[model samples]
Target: MKKQITFSIFITMLLLTACQERTTQQIIKLTNPSDFDRVDEPIVLARNIFTIKDIPNKNCIVLDKDQRAIPFQLDDLDEDGQWDEMFLLVDLKKKEQIDIIVMWTDQMSNKQFRQRANVRFANKAGDKILNDVNRLRSTDTKLSQAEFQMEGPAWENDVVAFRNYFDARNGIDIYGKRTKEMILHKVGINGQNYHQLDDWGMDILKVGTSLGAGAIAISSGDTLYRVDLPETSTYHLLVNGPLRSVFDLKHHNFKIGDHQLNINHRISIWGGAACYKSSVTIDGLQGNDALVTGIVNLHSDTYIEEKADQYLILATHDIQAEDQAALGMALLAKSKDVIDVSEAPKEGSGIVSTYLLKLKAENNKPTNFYFYAGWATQDKGYTDKSYFMKRLKKDAMRWSRPIIIK
Candidate 1:
């Protein structure tokens, strides 16, 4: 009788241990250390912060102070089976602290949330459409550009959308939206006309070899070289979020004065914003290399420049949009990173007719910048120069000083 009783006790303890392992909870404290209110601030948490086996594989549940479920995503940044990081968009007042309850479980949740941002990389695969990164990076630039939807990879948030020429030109373009609906996946393909005004919006910007938007390059001396037509390239959709989406592009064998380097650009877009964050990293980097990005200047010679709160705002408001309407574009960056702000030669062999931003970079270090596009038809407030500047400043502050997470 005593032996049977001990066996029962041992079984009960084993079951209890299994149950505890099946479900685990963690408390994450996030503080808005800035004086300004943090509205929809993006936060990233690496999986290395916790023990790998402690969190279950499939489900991640996050709760707020009131036990309200918050929308979040687990991302496998390296395309490995295990998730490497967590993404969440948080809101808090100045100096406010919010405690987040995170629970990992073996069970999945059926909870659904409104999607605010998206990523689309569609290519023709016979009768099927797929995001085959290799298909768009072929040597046949012109043919592939026509075959791919939106001429390349396109991503969007609620009100703003942007596309890249997966071809050798390697430029960025914008699609201004009337409604907050995610519509790029539907409109850009299947013989549809996006150049004209639709209920959603139209392709409002024209890109002509000029960086077009916030496209990047490398600068040596006074000449610039495009990070295009590489020997190999790949596109990865890192995270597709209900509040934010992240996509990455890899360029291998880009030549700069006979020195080859691999470059990676990871861009993230968030909800309710007309701008996107671009982070660029280079392999085989040298400290002397200058990273460059810019806005097209063919239609506007006069640009409004501002230095505010540790950032430089290089912007242009003009009647230069494709629809002949006023559009405002701005590039925001840290003042310290920018070494030169000048114009590429109006008629040159390299990237010309663009206002250039030459940035300081060290070996293998990442350089980041945010690009903004505001169309008058989409937001009449953008027609006013003052309102455009104010919007850029607010966003700059929010991105530069994100909420502190402990």
Candidate 2:
């Protein structure tokens, strides 16, 4: 009887060990073709398949081949206040297949690099200057010079930085980076003092009257116009992340010609990318007007490449900066929506090369596109136009074909 009892105990211990092994083996596979390491971009996995409920409880983990935990975050992509998606910021080698395990753990490891996205609105009470009864401007004038002054909110990630005007002209601007990490803090370091750069990077690009980098406009007949942010244009920071940052710029009633259009814009930026995604929704459109987005052609030395009906790329690499630096700017958009491309030259403001796309309002949904920039002095690769074009094509392909999540 003692021998039989000991045999039963041993069998029970063996079964428990098997169960633990099975739990640790739960994993998902990621397939990539390039040898280049994909940085802070989110690799989204389906939540329902994994049966994940609470991601922040230290219950979920991504394990590597050695069973070590990889840092990741869960995102509420729909903004319903409920976490539904899983994002892992990792580097996958060229032509490598990686297995990511989702298992229960008591301890979660902190991410080493700055894998998150950040945005700051100039909403401080003291930072506002009353331009008019309906308009408020930023007191910080880091970009202010003899004739040009800018006041608005700024955002950045590990790869790139962007800003939009908060006052009369709601134009978008780009901040070029020399470093791969965060550098927006170096801008306006002291109170009311705007420092363009620290030791890491500086604002190398310029935004004058032309779509300034990726500013949106309304195209009617032969003219392109922009709507100013009124008192009712409420600004909200949506997602502040270690992977993605999103914000909403809403205009309750913006006047475009005779119609008062309600516009909502959600801007998102990911890590390890030079471009930020801009999604805009304009209500009260008659479906006849065209939406125009463009890059500034300050020196008239701009090159455009349009691929049949797939994409339109507008690029400029010229000496158009305060330091006479060669800055490369480009706008990429869908070909079906593009109707025409034109050049609008302003006497003192600079030349605005615009891409016109058909504005189709479907149940008041949002329309989206991407705009990005590169500086020659910031990086050696950007000095070659071919390299910039190749990078753009790679990004476009990646955007088209997202990671397949099982």
* Candidate with the greatest TM-score versus the true structure: 1
List ranges where model 2 is wrong by over 4 Å: 1-26, 33-41, 46-49, 53-58, 93-96, 104-116, 123-150, 191-198, 220-223, 308-310, 348-363
Candidate 1 Cα misplacement greater than 4 A, ranges: 1-22, 50-53, 124-129, 135-145
Model 1: lowest-lDDT 10 consecutive positions: 123-132
| Candidates' RMSD to native | 7.4, 8.1
TM-score (all chains, Cα) for each model: 0.88, 0.78
lDDT tens string, model 1, 233-292?
Answer: 777787787878888888988877768888888998988778998999888765477889
The local distance difference test score of each candidate is: 0.80, 0.61
**lDDT over C-alpha atoms for residue 343 of model 1:** 88
Backbone clash count for every predicted candidate, in the order shown: 0, 6
Q: Considering every candidate listed, which one attains the maximal lDDT?
A: 1
